[model samples]
Target chain A: MADVAYLPGLPRMLPALLPADDNSSPWRFPQYFADHFSEVMGWLWAHTWLSVVPVIAGLIIALPIGWLASRHKWAYPPMMTVSGLLYTIPSIALFVLVPPLLGLDPLSPLQVPIALTVYSVALLVRVVADGLGSVSEETLQAATAIGYTPVGRFFTVELPIAVPVITAGLRVAVVANVSIVAVAGTIGMVNLGLLFDQGFKLSTDTPYYPPIVLGLLLCVLLALVLDLLVILLGRMLTPWRKAVRS
Target chain B: MIGNVLRWLNDPDNWNGTQFTTGIWAQLQTHLLYSVIAVLAALVIGLPLGLAIGHTGRATSLISGLNAVRALPTVGVLVLLVVIIAPHFHGRTSKGYIIPTLIVLILLAVPPILSNTYAGVQNVDPAVRDAAYGMGMTGPQVLWRVELPNSLPLIFSGLRSATLQVIATATIAAYVTLGGLGRFIYDGLAQQDYPQMISGGVLVAALALIADLVLALVQRYTVSRGLTKRFSKSTVGGAVAADLEEAGVEHT
Candidate 1:
């Protein structure tokens, strides 16, 4: 396997100090970082978008379906069942199966994001339905009595109230997607997961730590940031929550 | 594509082999073996800690920390462990692969179980705990007799989530040369064999569904009848959905 440090078109830093191609020298974080900084940033960039896009796409798609499930008593059971079953499918399986179903190349970069969207939808559907369902009957009547149209009521009243729950679901989806995207790297998808793949491949005779450690750090960091972002977004969307708390 | 996957699955050659790790049956066995072992080990560790936390209401910070651990990518951990630990064995033992894989699987499986158990115990109605204390039950007695029973649904929810995660991760274990259904997916990718890859996907999906179904049934049987009475206002499906919803909300 080729070392990421040797990848073309990136201006090298600390080339003289770069670890041997055979990995003779033990892992050094500074040397590795200097040698492959651009490459690492590229992986992180890909990782961020690959993970975040699916949750956004899934949330967009799930809202109407979840609203229907909450509104129609009969729709809730089947909707939950389908999503639950979908959620049960191993993510790797979904990644591989999705490409064929969609007539895309088996190794398409799109495979993972699409597969994750399935999961986000699977997860958020239940969250959305339950969040919307949490609105009390009296609250709905109040909205109606105030002459808000159903659409207007959903947008102004029910949706705002549902923000915390929906954001909670988004947090889970985002964090889980961050990890699952790395798993796709095992099958050759590009992302922070590729660093894991590279590190593993480099470890035939001796263990390599730099790439794996960097990947782990960046992944955990990404997940935490995304999680905090979702929480902050949740807080921003529900100002009344803080107003009541204060 | 479905036909191709079906044809690949229907082939007897894929299902039979003379040695372990040689066929679909062997891979299935290996996958389940790893998953079940990881879940059980997590249960041993997580259940106790969760019980103590839930019972004493101390060290709640540990639960939050464990929830953050959930965000660690499983494949990265598995590969890192393999890379870091495999060399220590000097190529003389398979423990290099097996140890790291199990560690990752167990690590991945523990959070949900621990948190759910804690939540289940904590969520036990205070009124009921008071009644148990009023009846002269000791703390341990109350935990065993009252909180544990009420906490069954959430505990099982955690168990199911962990099991599903372990099974899925065990498939990724094939990337590290551990034998399982993941072999088909990885090998298929290496060889560009889509049917075989899809077959692996189908088999894993089937395995996970069956495992979840079995766990659901076990939960249905194990939960006390009185608890069912409490949820009787909703249909069984609604009850399960409600439980699932709560599990997701609380665990996250």
Candidate 2:
């Protein structure tokens, strides 16, 4: 209600004012940027691969499981519950939990991607199931009526129609993975998180802003770029939706 | 390994701290305190904005923008914030780690709460809104009386997800040298105490599940029976799915 004393306007204004304060901080921009430029880029590349591979792997693994859940009514609840439980496990815990389970070194690069794949699969499984379920019964029936086998109908009809929804889930998976992969850095994995750790340790005596600020900017940039790519892909695959709109 | 963890958890020395200052109990309190405060802060910021956006059908882009904030690595954000903000509070006790940790948790919590609330209120039937208007209700009145009650289920679902996320992320607060159950995990990792680390993980998982269960019960009880029946399970699922989709879009 309007009567409620809420300052909804404040949040919208905070971001604009925040950067101005950065100028007064101890860290100088061009100098700091120049100092850490190459190192920052290296970490960014590591972060990108660590975040991205899991999503691709997760999507591949989730497809069959998602398809099975969508095909069988009774499978949905158990699938969602298991994945949901998987998701609730803390990222750091899973990051640590995996190396022991897989008998890998604690700092193994494989650990982060594997842990992230588990998360992406957890997130994407439900997304895949829901996306497949979103297909209209009549449309599916029509496909079957045209003499399509179950596999043929799924590949030819269901999968194409499900692209938007699946892509939507993929975007979430990718972004979430990016954030999570940074956690691995805290435990000594070389990634963008190394930047954060560097910044944190350096700031122990003074608030050194460059590595932290650069890492933040790069992570946000990566997320935005990946998000845009997914949206673009979604639009390309669902050309009929655009045609219908016109 | 499981037996070793159980033994570590049950050890008398593990529970030996003063009333609320040490041991598993104190760590649990620290974890809960961080999560609760962050979630409360998120609700304060997110709920009204979501309701306004839902009612007015405006600033929808804002919701998507907020959703992208969720994608920022929490660990990165936490450390960044600590590096930037911790020095300002350098002389103060506890403020250093607490401030940045709270900021990260609140940031994580806000998106889900905001998005779900917006979706819930917007999804309310237009006919119902028009009917309320026909009865001479003002915009504020209609929002408070009609939209709020109807949107309770989705709002609670958002709160549940946000709470779970905060609890999970709060475990990382210990990485910044704050006290929480994560202290055990971080300490164990540093000391190579596998049993302690595993137990910490077990405790956090248990806490998350328990908290979610409690919230689900609260959600079930608070919503009206008629509204629950009307919304139905599939509608709720659809709402959650749609919210997740929006979350996906925003993160990108």
Best by DockQ: 1
Q: DockQ (Cα-based) per candidate?
A: 0.44, 0.41
Q: How does residue B72 of candidate 2 score in lDDT?
A: 75
For each prediction in turn, the share of the native Cα contacts (below 8 Å between chains A and B) that it retains comes to: 0.88, 0.63
TM-score of each: 0.89, 0.85
Candidate 1, residues A60-179: lDDT per residue as tens digits?
Answer: 999999999999989999999999999999999999889778988777878888899999999999999999999988999999999999999999999998888899899999999999
iRMSD, model 1, in Å: 5.5
In order of the candidates, what TM-score does chain B achieve?
A: 0.89, 0.87
Model 2: lDDT to the true structure: 0.83
lDDT of 2 at A114: 91
Q: Model 1, which residues run further than 4 Å from truth?
A: A1-27, B18-21, B230-252
- Among all windows of ten consecutive residues in candidate 1 chain A, which has the lowest summed lDDT? A8-17
- The Cα error of candidate 1 at residue A199, in Å, is 0.4
Model 1 residue A236 CA deviation (Å) reads 2.1
